[model samples]
Target: MKQGIHPEYHPVVFMDSQTGYKFLSGSTKTSQETVEWEDGNTYPLIRVEITSDSHPFYTGRQKFTQADGRIDRFNKKYGIKDENAAE
Candidate 1:
């Protein structure tokens, strides 16, 4: 609760370049680019590469490479069987 020393906290739109998702939120971020919103009014739009809409984690596209089952392949290729393996 100060005077004019505080920065401007305004509504800004975040546009996801990957999924074309638009989100409205308050930000101190500045942008020289502007775009017309659904209200027929223009607002500052921030273009980002990825967002939750297209993120791999959110979309469940995360992949964990096992290197073609290296452990199993190695055991099979070398005839090295572990006693812990169940039949």
Candidate 2:
């Protein structure tokens, strides 16, 4: 509730450089670039390296890796033999 002490919060456009996806939102971040939005008005353009649009997790391209020799060790320790596993 203070005057002249808060950063300017206004409509800004976040652009994903990788996928060329743009979304409009309110932010206090300042940018040297500007883009004309759908309303034919210019707003601050912030170029981001990765957004949810292009991220692996959001795009379902995420990879999960199991530690080398860990699964075998666990199976041996717990005596959990795979039914189809070879001796």
Candidate 3:
């Protein structure tokens, strides 16, 4: 609750670079770039590489890696045999 100590918060447009998706939200960050929003207002434009719109997890395009354990992976890589397999 101090005065003259907080950064200015205002509407800013975050744009997903890959998909060209734009959304307006309040932020303390500022930029020299500006963009016209859908609400007929101009706000600071911030370019980001990834957002929910283009992220693999949100878009359901994520690739699942192998579930092999560390020991199993190391043995396979160095062609080592598992002694426990003979028991």
1-87, model 3: which lDDT tens digit per residue? 999999989999999999999999999989999999988999999999999999998999987797989999999999999988866
Of the candidates numbered 2 and 3, which has the greater TM-score value?
3
Winning model by lDDT: 3
> Which candidate do you rate higher for lDDT, 1 or 2?
2
Lowest-sum lDDT 10-residue window in model 3 = 78-87
After the best TM-score superposition of candidate 2, give how far the Cα of residue 40 lies from its true spot, in angstroms. 0.7
Q: Give the TM-score ranking, best first.
A: 3, 2, 1
Per-residue lDDT of candidate 1, residues 18-38 (tens digit) = 889998878988899998888
Q: Candidate 1, which segments miss by more than 4 Å at Cα?
A: 1-5, 66-87
Q: lDDT per residue, candidate 2, 1-87, as tens digits?
A: 989999988999999999999999999998999999999999999999999999998999987785548888888889988889777
Better of 1 and 2 by TM-score: 2
The true-versus-predicted C-alpha distance at residue 42 of model 3, in Å, is 1.5
- CA-lDDT, candidates in order: 0.88, 0.93, 0.94
In candidate 3, clashing pairs total 0
Off by over 4 Å in 2: 64-87
Which run of 10 residues does model 2 get worst, by summed lDDT? 62-71
